[model samples]
Target: MSEQAQQTSNSYRSGPDERGHFGIYGGRYVAETLMPLILSVEKAYKDIEDDPSFWSEFYTLARDYIGRPSPLYLAQAMTKHLGGAKIYFKRDELNHTGAHKINNCLGQILLAKRMGKTRIIAETGAGQHGVATATVCALFDMPCTIFMGATDIERQKPNVFRMKLLGADIRAVTSGAGTLKDAMNEALRDWVSHVDDTFYIIGTAAGPHPYPAMVRDFQSVIGNEVREQITEREGRLPDTLIACIGGGSNAIGLFHPFLDDPGVAMIGVEAAGYGLDTGQHAASLSGGKPGVLHGNRTYLLQNEDGQITEAHSISAGLDYPGIGPEHSWLHDSGRVSYAAVTDDEALEAFQLCSKIEGIIPALEPSHALAHVMKIAPDLPADHVLVMNMCGRGDKDIFTVADKLGVTL
Candidate 1:
């Protein structure tokens, strides 16, 4: 291993324990009926983690199929525009399916195949995960089902059609304002009913036991590559790492590899929909308390009666009532800082990046860019900030056009 890799490996010592508790934030908060199946999944994942062949196949697909080692580009235009920090983008948006969602999907589909599963089920918000799952299922020839909110289906119609074109069954969930959390609830119910032949492909770094940890391990490829790439390019680690957080898979993917680097500031940007004061946003860590949701104990947006509140964001991807359990733990432990970006702020950054960098970012990463715009101007010119460009904006043009009062 290289010196940086060795140091990073040594530094990451605060992972979850055997029971998947990340300092009391992550644990199996699932139904009793699903416990045995979850345990079986945990065991299967343990076996795969210890097997070299599993990784060989996974990495082979990552490189040849899903396109690994996504470019880390110095956004010179953005840097000059900001006029302070030297900004870089880890362009996972260039990957197949136009998002980092493929990274976790590729890993989970392989695991599902190994576990002898024939059907795959997943929940998505912005439709990236649903589209990614559908793509992988087509590759593996496994029947696929995607659960998405009715609102999301309308907002992300292009991706919904893409999922259909990929031969996956798209189920529209219509409960609780019909958004991400409701879609997840519906997917979980389906999983419980079809446990024999189905594997639930959770899109984010949240969920019960092995799901969060497993998803993080799979998605950590983003951080690992960033560590190597940035080290080679700058001969040093980044000063700050930024990514948008909904369920926080992409954020954790970028943040996990740098967790041990105390000098590297980790920032997760959440959706501030209208603003935190309006109670219409999805800034879970900023405005929420500890609660159990979706089979994991994490920071959640809930009422006094412990009811999960609806989340709102212009970016369908960042609309969530709770974040990943690991992120909740990281926030409480002071290992990472959480910030909120309003819809208007993200839209501004979205247009700014398009005009300046020629990279039309999806609204998800636009949230991260919004915060980057906020702090980059104040930092030293020599300071480096790496942000995850997790998704592209092609699927989001309709929403953007509609929001800007333009006729399609």
Candidate 2:
């Protein structure tokens, strides 16, 4: 394919900028204390990526270790209930650490090894990323530290325990609102200090340039396998693909390779908290305005002074104050549609999936399932649809039960 042909493809991420900045959206946004370290890792990633041997080894490790061909299972019963749309699931929940997060974490640890880094640092909100990061560090024998909000430490105790079992040092950030934001602040502070041998493995595609792109690349296997499986089963692409967007990594990864197919639609669901108009939400594209933050220019949930506002999503994973730059661009270009699903609807869908499909999905991905409830009913029975059921919801049952007043 010509460069022009490839350029026009529906990929959410683009550009010639090597440092991961998509236009002005992504660039180094760290404190001056960490600039040199960020740049050093950037250089290492570029150099190692250019070497065929490293790519070969990385691909081998990915296919074998992380279970690259995560099954694309046909949601037969769910589809029949929808009464028209063929719903299949890209089952990343069965992955090594039990989500798409592990794909990126393993790749990052491999990169860290190549870079001669001896330590790994990461920040987590709901702790999925922290557990995945810690797990990979254990496999590589690298010292690991995971920063998490003190509040999340308690809410996601299972993940914290998993991280400890994997031997990661956990620091519960107590500052600010004591959530993902505070944990991120603390992690960044640590990066600025331990610039020498630390590699920070971000969980999603939202961070600075290469991160969004890199994470997408790591997670893109979801879509890659989907393409092959869809061809074998349905012989054509579905009319739409739906995935929840926290930092937008999974959605973008699944949507990127399929971007240029004008006939196929991509939907990214965000958390609506109570409702979008209630001032308690995390629907960045649906509710936020353009602003610069965290080292890149992008749409930010902000206040009157343009200070970034904290975001609210019942799903801690979706409680991000800013979005990946590529998502902002895709929304602006009309290449993708962004929607919001309220917490009540998400929880209902979460329960429904477990009750009906025998699969319990994370609250983050449950946002996508809520939209599926709305969408599948409208499509023709023969039409196709697939959702990224990102993780299991065993970690969320108690909180969900308390919220909905379910005795169980």
Clashes of each: 0, 6
Residue runs of model 1 more than 4 Å from their true location after superposition = 1-12
Candidate with maximal lDDT: 1
lDDT of candidate 1 over 76-116, digit per residue (tens): 99999989999999999999999999999999999998999
Alpha-carbon lDDT of model 2: 0.82
What shift in Å separates residue 279 of candidate 1 from its native position after superposition?
0.5
* Candidate 2 stretches greater than 4 Å from native: 1-13, 16-19, 406-408
Question: What lDDT score goes with residue 119 in model 1?
Answer: 93
lDDT of 2 by residue, 44-153 (tens): 67777678887787778777877778888888878877676889899988887878888888878888898888999998988889989998899889999999998889
Quote the positional error of residue 29 for candidate 2 in Å: 2.5
Q: Local error of candidate 2 at 198, Å?
A: 1.0
At residue 43, give the lDDT of candidate 1. Answer: 93
Q: RMSD for each model, in Å, please? A: 3.6, 2.8
